[model samples]
Target chain A: MTDMSTRWKRTLCVALTGISIVTVAAASASAGEISVWVWDKAFNGDTMREAGEIYTKAHPETTFNVDDTASQDDIRAKLQTQLLAGSTEGLPDIVLIQDDIAQKYLQSFPGAFEPLSDSIDMSVFAPYKVAAATLDGKSYSVPFDSGVTGLFYRSDYLEEAGFTAADLENITWDRLVEIGQAVKEKTGKQLLDLDMNDTGVIRMMMQSAGEWYFNEDGSLHITDNAALKKALETYAKFYQADLVKPVSGWAEYTGAFTNGEVAVVPVGVWITATIKANADQSGKWAVAPIPRLDMEGSVNASNQGGSSWFLLSSSDNKEEAIDFFKTVWAGDQDFYQDILIKRGAVGSLLSAREGEAYKASDEFFGGAPVWQNFSTWLGQIPSVDYGTFTAEVDAAVAAQLPTIIQGGDIDAALQAINDQAQQQMQ
Target chain B: MNPALLRRGLVYALLSLAAFISVFPFYWMIIGATNASADIIRGKTTPGGALFANAATFFATVDAPRIFMNSAIIAVVGTALTLVVSSLAGYGFEMFRSRIREKLFALLLLLLSIPFAAMMVPLFVMFSQAKLVNTFVAAILPTVASIFIIFYFRQATKAFPSELRDAAKIDGLNEWQIFLYVYMPVMRSTYAAATIIVFMANWNNYLWPLIVLQTADNKTITLILSALTSAYTPDYGMLLFGTVLATLPTLVIFFLLQRRFVEGMLGAVK
Candidate 1:
């Protein structure tokens, strides 16, 4: 009986081993599908799917294995590990990386990303967005969205405060605070919402003034950077005037404005869909240019929360990736218009801005030709050197935000930021 | 007697309150799964009628069978190996104690203090050279020789009766045979507790698996759920539903083993 059992066990194990090898062989023999890694299922992933459908219609043989199952943090972890491990076999041919992180990947692992400047015309994108992807004159991204900041105000709430769209057109950050206080008093709604842990407002304010945390040479310029200090002071003024609703995280931030408890959201163009999500209030909203910083060089235009596509140098399908990006992302103006109308995605492709969708009015925002407005403002965004140390510095700035708003000394705060950022950047 | 009974009542009330506090998040998860995404984020604490819709979306989007299979393989293989190697070392050190082995065991405990983040880069380099990158083998191998499990097994081995091992030896059984037959069956609850722990740790593992599992085909449930949440306009109902699904296996395992693990108290006689 024991001998029979042994024979059966051995036979079973042998069959399973054979099955495994056969399956692996079959898998390897099949035609490879393009694997895409993206964050944000509803936004980027769905948009990619729409693009894939368009491409697949032309070439029926091409298949896509788009994986939107990993969040931003997961993508970072996965990409970093694969690069550090020196194994790029399983990496997707194309991956979506946030604009803020483009420089980090470019510098940390110098040959990991393929230079797209040779294939796609970098001048076709917004000069500033393209500049963020450049290292040593080799730009590496197919710029996807324009996070051009806009003041999404409730038209009803604004009208009640005796302010028109033209009133918001060329306003400074100080004027916005005064208007916020007046709006709060008149409508019982906070003019804007703020998160104590986030530096988004400060970032928006500084960048609107064409300034950054670092100088052109990548050195810390916190103390003497007039725009940054003024941005800080204006951020504090909103809190001191009690015209802001304090919230935490994305959900709370959105909830505050979406519930109509806050009159306006001073954020990126990407928030249009999120604002439009309240269908009942569609006609009540309008887009205005971002408030300018008090400093001399500050402009009314700045970018935030944009991402771009990079081709992996080590990918087996590098030529295919380059061809795919060039044909659809860089060349197809109609495809850009389709994505914009359907997904509210504002592409950086300059030629795409000449498409019919760019001229169309959005009924959701009171029939304003919002895209035309965005394109005009996109040019005014100040060209700043986004140093690789931005994340480290951003964390330092976020830590001091609560204290900075509570009437804390600006110089002491700057010293704290310098001390902490220097330690972490090491 | 009356005062003592009143005190016992007070203890039960507090215990009930603590249990309620611990279980509220799980309750919220289930409630969220039943509601629309918009309503849930609006802080709607009550359940709604969206459970079926959420379930449909989850099933449509995900490869449920494949993900659960991947999770099962890692947990099973990881659990079985961890128990065998760790228990042997534990028994060996306790039964056949030498000064060198004791010092080595002490050193292993100190090594545990070094954070996982510091070791990740070096470990990735080693795995890449061995051609184990992006494989289940890479994920399982690093955790198989877990010091925490070794420490646990050693602590449990103290309660292992010396008399049983001695009798087996007297009966002409070898050390291997004694360990296999006497120690294993006697320390069943210890194994049970370890299985629950290792399974939970392997199941909910995020950062390491995110780094190691390169292909979407090999990615696990946690990775999938995380990706879903990162979407610009995440469907919270679907996400909460997916999380509820991911959490069940560990919850079920703990529910079953926890009774045996707790009731079979360690050092009760000692």
Candidate 2:
């Protein structure tokens, strides 16, 4: 009995001590380390690390600790939970936030993020990037990457269809469908791959016309939104023409283009790395400006998935973080060139377009200055205010996708989307 | 062919189909671990020559030793604590005679109906207030008192022979001694079953650990693997390799306790 009780006591003692040791070890992050939370190691994580290294070299007192051990959704859940719990202890000094969902955080948790506009020059970034994190005339983020939309197509496939790169330039969605049909007939390959669960194509189409699911006042704008109606119609046109190879997830979607099963990929600049990953596909892939909607205000350029870095209001090393941001992120032009070349990261700094890396032609894309073309389009991407309920509206939009592609009434679909979005917003 | 023989053949075919359905994903994962990311994305089901390269990438990208150690510590410690706490409650609820015992057990079961999502914020607030955020303790603590495990143990305890407790008592054993010496030894199979269940749960736990364990060094393999999958260009081969490694511990535990686990499920005393 004594032996058993002694063993139990010893075990309890060891466990309690072990827990305390862990608690102590975990609680002690050094004073000058500016911890950052980023999702992708190759893209944002390494880019931020490079910036941090530069800042550390100059300053010497401050160092960075970038944690990319959580997915974007996981990070969002953690940040949202901590913010709602009103606990700032677990949050990092800086966080990478996607542009579309930036409003949800800023509005939901006011005073949670430190406004960067006062210290950093918001004008140097693309207007659309700055506008994403701006609330009440103060921008909260340092724009990192530009998700500027481009039409990356297989040049060989296009040529086989008796079409040149010039034929794709400045085309409308309707014209693209005709081109797609011609390409399909000639090459026997689908024009593009699409996932119905993703509203990316539709969202990009609407954003090209400088519109979103919400009006200026942030109310649900669906039924009468001309841009949305046209976008949905264009989406259906691809399915109707059988130009789309129906894919389910990210792997299949990327696989379709990377494996040469599809001819074109119209997506953000961030997909450059993914497309470029297949080394053998080099010289075959060429990028052109995205096809515009056939509307009065619609442009050829649009935005997709981009993110910006926000300083936490609870940061202990605020001045150092702000200085690091200003010195490396906002001021460094050559740094942008390095990340672009190494990681294929497209920065939102407008000045980076003038850098030598941007002007250098790539043999990969048949010696075309694809980066230059992307930069040119980057300037023209129509900015839209992705309201707080974009995610909710996006879900509503995605739910109606199956019916919409089957020649369902666009007006009726729009009404359903609107009703669903309205209910979700509440 | 004879109808009986034909039916037997059909059953064999169906059983084989069922077994393949159950095992194909594991086979695919192992095959994927040996292939390149591009090959996997291309939907290649056959093996390739990228196993070493994939493993090298995974090791270079992740601190595999530290990560697995963290996972092991959480899983082992959590399993130990959950078995002890929940089994004790199970034993007490079954062995002791209290007027409100059934009502209290019912209340605990009722608490199980409340989703973890609803309680997460409050739990976070509590841990943050305790200055326990980012600690393994925080990750392990919340899961140790799992209501489902307690309920599972209580049901298993009903099958526990109470006459042994009476025997131990008559042999001059106190309540604590009876629980420690007689009850625990007799319920070894139950403990074995709960060990696998709790260990697997602790090992594969995602959301709570993701929220609590903020540092990269402190993160578990499950959290890391999930993050790796969401990378801009995920190396599927390397990810599958990591997954295979993460799965091994649970697999070993399940296999080691296989007989007892089955017996325990049947009935603890039996």
Best by TM-score: 2
Q: Candidate 1 falls in which docking quality class?
A: acceptable
Kindly report the root-mean-square deviation of model 1 from the true structure over all alpha carbons. Answer: 6.0
Off by over 4 Å in 1: A1-33, A56-63, B1-17, B264-270
**Chain A TM-score compared with the true chain A, each model in order:** 0.92, 0.95
lDDT of 1 by residue, B1-270 (tens): 699999999999999999999999989999999998888768899989999999999998888889888888888888888778888887787888676987899899999999987778778766554445566777777888778888887888888888988899899999999988888878888888888888888888777777777766777898888888766666789889999999999989988888666743452222
Error of 1 at B257 (Å): 1.5
lDDT of 2: 0.91
Q: Encode model 1's per-residue lDDT on A1-426: one tens digit a residue.
A: 969756764665565554434321211112446678888767788778877777777767766767777888888887887788676756787899988878889999999999989878887788888988899999999898888888889988989988888988888989998888888888888889998888887888888877888887778988887888898888889889998889987777888888888888888899888888889988899999999976677888998879898888876666766777888888889988998988899888888778899999989899999999998888778767778898899999988898988999987888899889888888
Interface RMSD of each: 6.5, 4.7
DockQ for every model comes to 0.33, 0.49
Colliding residue pairs in candidate 1: A40-B231, A40-B232, A41-B231, A69-B227, A70-B227, A71-B227, A209-A298
Please report how far candidate 1 places residue A116 from its true position, in Å: 1.9
